[model samples]
Target: MSDLLARHRAVMPNWLALYYDEPIEIVSGKGNRVVDASGKSYLDFFAGILTNMIGYDVPEVREAVERQLATGVVHTSTLYLMRGQIELAEKIARLSGIPDAKVFFTNSGTEANETALLLATYARRSDQVLAMRQSYHGRSFGAVGVTSNRAWKNSSLSPLNVHFLHGADRHLTPFRGMSDADYVAACVEDLRHVLSTVVGGDVATLIAEPIQGVGGFTMPPDGLFAAYREVLDAEGVLFISDEVQTGWGRTGSAFFGIQNHGVTPDMMTFAKGLGNGFAVGGVVARGDLMDGLHAVGLSTFGGNPVSMAAANATLDYVLDHDLQANAARTGALIVDGLREAAPRLPIVGDVRGKGLMFALDLVDPATGAPAPALAARFMEETRKAGLLAGKGGLYGNVLRMAPPLTLTVEEAAEGLGIIVDALETVNAEVTS
Candidate 1:
């Protein structure tokens, strides 16, 4: 074992997972590439699970944070008036698409979702919630309960009466082969049935990832949430779009992934890319729902000035530079390349994603079943080829890629070449 791995294992919890058979210790990064402790550089395809929205060592983001650092006061608590926080919130509110949208900052996506839950439950006055099957909101106590992915649920107990909904994981579902319209219809029907029977009384809200992030980039058909929103609207259940991974123009087609479906969520929680690696997460909600939380509480680190500065700069960069259009154009190159190569590569069962976010379902070619072992081997091969990627899925058999939005066409080609080579190498080893 590597010395660092041995040290990590001795101190860290065994359940805290690490990627790769021999994990590479990243030491530094710039643009879309990172260098390991051993001084080996790699094309960072995952971009820290889509958190580095723009890129690493970004001058704009760095300068903003540096300017805040020079101010000497970083944490003033949410009790005081903060210019940075309010300005960032204003930008987010305008872009949120929710009329009279109010912003609440948190330290992470999990907290943002939790705060949204608190407001939602209080507003609707119920503990019942509708969560998507194969979803992963976060790892916190409240988050774990609503996470429908079995692997992510460490605890047997939950605070909310969570009812799992179908249609998120299209590949695993019986309706996998269904057309987009049919799949959307089936999912909508499931939502209607659950609301009418399972909950019985009022459901606080239906929280869902716009594109199920930790669930292996599982994407439901367009208009899926639109139908869900329609059903929930009639029942007075709020719709919360968890845009932790799919926010910040990452989806290419829209600012938030829910926008693609033509539905503006009652509440939208975002984090990952918004801060561009600074700790920033928040929820934008309708005025009534946001103000409905009766308890007097404050998040000490929720709106740290430094973080707010980073987020403001990041958002400004994203908007001024038009990263959304960039995501769409660049993401297409990777998606098209992967789709084109899927037929030639035997282990590749499916290529699914939109914009900068997408995934490759690795499987046993003969059986067409999820091949977790093969996925592991494929990751190792990519590491050897100096391409850092991501792995996830309900079955742990998918290779996910959400590179920085600023990935150049040439960089995309280079990454694709490395990916194809790695896949080929892994395929040969398995089939041999």
Candidate 2:
């Protein structure tokens, strides 16, 4: 181990942990592969929690950064305008197909979400913000207030008028007996009930991830959004779609994830894949909503020239290379492979995802309950076998396989093989 690694473990507080850190220290990356300090390579299926859509160190992105550096890095301030920032804003707006929408950039997903929450609340002059249960919206003060996961909240709890709707966990209740259409209708009704009972007129906005990424890759039944939109519109509540984990071609779609469901939101937050690993995030809002927040919020490094340049390059690459369509094609292949292998593995419970973002839920073979320990063991075993995977879900039983959009078909197959091997090992251990 490196001296720095030893120093880190000695000095760092283990209580502040987030992820289950692997022993290997990643030193470098190229395309879909990451190399550790010891020079061992691992096929990167994690993709920095689904942030690196374009893979690592793409020449075009590197060239763009180099060109920006040559011209001197542009700092973000309220005082000036940078060309790169303007270009990226325009490009994103055009691609989003929202002719009058405006963009406010941030350095990370949490900040972008914080901005959206602030704007939604301030504009509507209400304190209540409704979010779906089992959703993972970042972990900042305001973002954490809206996030549905209590486990992630830790001890930093505060008083906030945040309401929860039972959308993602609906499968566990009366929703399980309903058809898809009826389930969605019931979800929308629940949203309305939450607003009426808990939120009331104080409700300023309702935010949700179109596809619950960290909440076990839960897919909302069709017509749910349309129903929710109708209710929000009627009640004059702002609808904010947190697309931090699903935007920018991850869902095999263009722009925001809501587009796939055939409904638009009053505000949309994006990060993760936006800069393709270069640390960029932003909030796009409807024209009316945006016009109200023109001078209220600001960030120092929100839309700096270098970050904007990286975002522009990423957007261009996604479109010019047709990566969105590729995600659909490749994602289908991987999902089908998992389905075919599911029956052979007793630990496998469910497979659900869209595009490059997918999850395989592991369950106890006997009780059919979520098996978080088994999932963690599988992740460790997979990493040992040179495949990098992530664990998600409220129970932490969903093996999140959100690789880079640039992952080739062969690479997907190879990564899946490691997962299969890990499952076999886990099953054997349980049996023994």
User: Which candidate number maximizes TM-score?
Assistant: 1
lDDT of 1 by residue, 122-190 (tens): 888889888998999899988998998889889968888999998776665588689889888888888
**What lDDT does each candidate get?**
0.89, 0.81
Instruction: Evaluate model 1: give its lDDT.
Output: 0.89
Q: How many residue-pair clashes does candidate 2 contain?
A: 0
lDDT of candidate 2 over 210-296, digit per residue (tens):
888778788786557778888888888888888888887877855567887788787889888878778899888876677786565
TM-score of each: 0.98, 0.95
Off by over 4 Å in 2: 16-22, 74-76, 155-159, 294-297
Clash pairs detected, candidate 2: none
Pairs in steric clash, model 1 = none
